[model samples]
Target chain A: MMSELHINLSESLKSKPASDALGFGKYFSDHMFIMDYSSEDGWHDARIIPYGPISLDPSAMVLHYGQEVFEGMKAYRTPLGEIAMFRPDMNLKRLNNSCERISIPQVDTEFVLEAIAQLVRIDQEWIPDGEENALYIRPFIIATEAALGVRASKQYMLMVILSPVGAYYPEGIHPVSIYVEEQYVRAVRGGTGEAKTSGNYASGIKAQEIAKTKGFSQVLWLDGKQHKYIEEVGSMNVFFKVNGEILTPALTGSILQGVTRDSVITLLREWGYTVVERVISIEELFEASRQGLLEEAFGTGTAAVISPIGSLSWGDKNTEISGGVTGELSQRLYDSITGIQRGKLADPFNWVYTVK
Target chain B: MMSELHINLSESLKSKPASDALGFGKYFSDHMFIMDYSSEDGWHDARIIPYGPISLDPSAMVLHYGQEVFEGMKAYRTPLGEIAMFRPDMNLKRLNNSCERISIPQVDTEFVLEAIAQLVRIDQEWIPDGEENALYIRPFIIATEAALGVRASKQYMLMVILSPVGAYYPEGIHPVSIYVEEQYVRAVRGGTGEAKTSGNYASGIKAQEIAKTKGFSQVLWLDGKQHKYIEEVGSMNVFFKVNGEILTPALTGSILQGVTRDSVITLLREWGYTVVERVISIEELFEASRQGLLEEAFGTGTAAVISPIGSLSWGDKNTEISGGVTGELSQRLYDSITGIQRGKLADPFNWVYTVK
Candidate 1:
């Protein structure tokens, strides 16, 4: 699949950042992957070019119409000193789903996977080995047409850039406070909510900023239709443990299906825990807290495998969850998932794709 | 305000497109206006440089998260061989409102108006002098910070580009067929519908494409919450005349407050017509058609001024509006607005801003 891939290495590679100082998405690797799509050529001229600025026409449709989709994955340095990816196939599938929803052309998944592997191999030395540190992989496509119509662009550019990072949260694995937002809506059914598109993220900044100003680390979004049902926490899929049962919002065409979320659910189910995927309202969760039945809560995504919720608040109601600390189950799930990703634990689910 | 403005003229200008051949947003003028924004320096270093491609880092936030807002207005060559703008202050004011909604920094509207006047003065020849011809001005701001974090950017670039446009619709002045979209939602009450941001436009592409497949010119979006009430017709604000009353959707948070829509309402009210701004449902519209009370229907925006709707369809119901032709009121409104815009009609409302 990479037979036609062209390589253009950087003339002077960037100095690697200290592992301890590597904040999320700050520094880029020396080389990045790029592919172009046109109506005539159909995704031709795949190449690895020097990581640098991309020149775009001022009227490029992506800048004006938000015609873009992105995927976030990571490459980890294993215990044995080999690089591996955690469920990259899932990311590729989700990327295609996003493309279908945004009316952009989908890439061949297998071919794209091979491209990722080749790029990672060339920049393998750039991957950091600090605790919870990995090479953050960002694969995004933008409409590159120089025209200004409302329709989909006939030209597009898909690029994959690698960024070395420490942790998604500034506090690392500590539990964080979340505010339940009722004012601004993120995604609604029949909208671009389920897709991993830029518009969904753009619509979320105001709510997140409000939560931030209120001293919350993230905003727990309610459904757009009624603003009652819990949809997602920040950019991740959320879950709650009440008594002995696990609850997660169903993929009801508005919530993004996170890869780590699926892994968490599967792991819990395999361990004989009952995980329910249904519409969970904020009122029900508040009532559960009032009854002293809400045990643990967390958000799951690629950036943070498991972000435990220490405190939750909405309107005038606020409560500390799990005594404002990471719960036992949250720690265990994080260890198990990260362990599998780092090749330190047994791969019972065949989740890790080792790059040769 | 213009003291700090710097001008860098292009060495060579491209041949202007033939007035008849000018399509929407196809040809760019020789020069464009640009301004950079940083948290520390504020919006500074405003300049007019040769129109060309802009260089952006691969991880620019706008490319990944769609942090962008844009405005659409035109520079018209009036009958007196002078340039004029139609309510540009309104466009700039709305641009600020869009910036607030998207968490982008707001530009000084009065200062930006000077910037637009200077840019148009430099490229005044780009304004085509044909019937319904104007220099389409697109002013947009994009987040330029090159980072992968899902947050507001600290750096941004605001740009103004000019394109000689003939008409928004290829069919020109004819009534268009509209599909009442129920399966795909454009916006909900708490969404970014009222803002002139990129995400809203991106979310509408799929529905528009589907409508095109069904032989419709555009999609008439229903409310996201119920998918019952009419929100917008294509990208424009919609209006209907039923039983001698002019009706348009109210300025709900989810509907764009178009400058042209406001103008039409004012003109109708001045003509002693009772114009009602309230919620109008698709069921009510169909019932009006059934009872022979449905009259003229059209969409209003900066692009088309007034686009007459000939036929509308939803589910199994299809009806011809105004006997499948342009309504008398629609034509009269279009003529009155365009005449005022072209300096043929008396400026009773002081809507035209003459550019020196």
Candidate 2:
């Protein structure tokens, strides 16, 4: 079902030279990819048109009911100046998982990958050639049907938009301070937490804001039930190092199975590190930190390959992780991931997908 | 601060016959009220424009990140043929509370109410004169800024759109079957469960669909922690009658404080019924049903004022309530609330806010 995509290239490309100087998701390329889905027509009318406004009915299900899911990846510029996407298949799988959870129709992963590859290929010039810069790719599906009823939509729109992003950390990879949110939760068991959907992110905004106000970069959300177990951060999967062993939250239904998080875990195991996935209780983590067993903490996501945690503030206690700097393990994980992405390291798992 | 609103009404209106109707959130009136807010301009560019497409940047926060909140109310036609809105001030206050939680800028409640009134007054003819028919009002705010970073949006849009709706149960108030969703939780403590936001509703779609497929009208969500306590039904606040006492989930931070839910509580208390807002454990409810202490169960929302629960299926256990018919308390509460809204009974509580 490889239909010819209607390509409406912009009359002229507008260059954003300073985009590399800005942070991620602050700038866009000239064009975007869009495809419409209806129960009657399936997925049809694919197009790559000028990046502009999308007119949606005010009562569109996405607006009122939040029937939407999205994927986040990047188009990386290698040292050879060739543009590629890292593990797009994973994003496609996650996107479908999110769609299934949200009751949206499952899109063919092959179709989505082909569309995305073509999109990045056409917008190749937008891929920033820098250590920390790339073209951030956001593919989202929204319910466009103009009905306010609390039911699945019959019509939907799947779109892929490119943003020319600078470094995720404009000031370089400095360890961040994270606030332990004891009140607000990001996801619960049997919620859309495992899916790359918008609801989970939306729910975390308040807690994230509170974290920011308290002088933290992001929130460390606990499980919704007892608020005692560790879950994840706002947009990333969390990992902690206890006694030189790496532990992350298991896929217990409430945490997003991030592509970066998965890749990091694989690379860690490949490097002979003890990577464990299980329910990490907050009480255990706090005790471990106090006992000097908790060595490091970091979060993994597409935007930030691995963001090191400098310190954690939960309740009234603020504890520094590995002397409030990036630990050796955190640095190694970041280096391996970025090195592979930047073509500095050998691609052992064949994770990089060239945009051609 | 009342800035002059730019009321740009649509030149033409699309009129639909009174008999042609959908349940809710389907057909829209000709015009809509919109206002734009930016960090620079504050809140400006308020207008009543033709109901049409809203152009948004591909990287708009709401599209990808789900930084959105909304409120639902209705405009009714009194016997004097005057269009009136229910307690809109309550909606406005709740909207602001949601905005504050999500870090979105707050709109003036008076401004919002006046704008809603203006829109409803302009679309007064669209309000169906039949019983239980009115113009459903959906006021929503979305983060319109075209940035993908995990931060609050600097720009926002506050808009009110009206849709002409028929009775939710056009075939009369038939008892609805509800499935006990022990696996999928709608919200958790410390989440946006209480806010009238898009993410909270989006997370419930899958659960609702599963219930629907299982021959139920809605899914009764459990508390995210233990999945033991009954929280709410899809989109509506839930209620239970056990041993002649009306019981509901307290404001435990995971359930929406529905206006209809609050109104029902008030009406029940004034009607000399024992009402309690506390955690209602699912096990207790099931045990009560077994012991013949559970008398009735229902859901309350603006769309479905009060829908009787015929039966509940949790895991392998199936329980029927009130012989699969409307219970006496359900009938009395429904009659009192609907009677007040439909101008059939005395509203001593002054719950109705008459539109000027």
Q: Say which candidate scores most in DockQ.
A: 1
* Tens-place lDDT digits, model 1, residues A161-235: 999988899678889999999989999999999999998998899989989998999999999999999999999
Fraction of native contacts under 8 Å reproduced by each candidate: 0.82, 0.84
Docking class of 2: high
| Alpha-carbon deviation at A17 in model 1, angstroms | 0.8
Where is the poorest 10-residue window by lDDT in model 1 chain B?
B165-174
Q: lDDT of all predictions, in order shown?
A: 0.94, 0.85
lDDT score for candidate 2 against the true structure: 0.85
Residue-wise C-alpha lDDT for candidate 2, range B1-356, written one tens digit per residue: 33577777778879675644566677888899999999999988888888998888778889877889999898888786666677788888999999987789988889878878888887788887777687889999999998888778999999999888887766556678889988787888778888888888888888888777888888898888888888888788999999989999999888888899989898888878899999989889999999998899999988888899999998899899999989888888777887777667777888777877
Clashing pairs in 1: none
Best of the candidates, TM-score: 1
Error of 2 at A295 (Å): 2.5
| Per-candidate alpha-carbon RMSD to the true structure | 0.7, 1.7
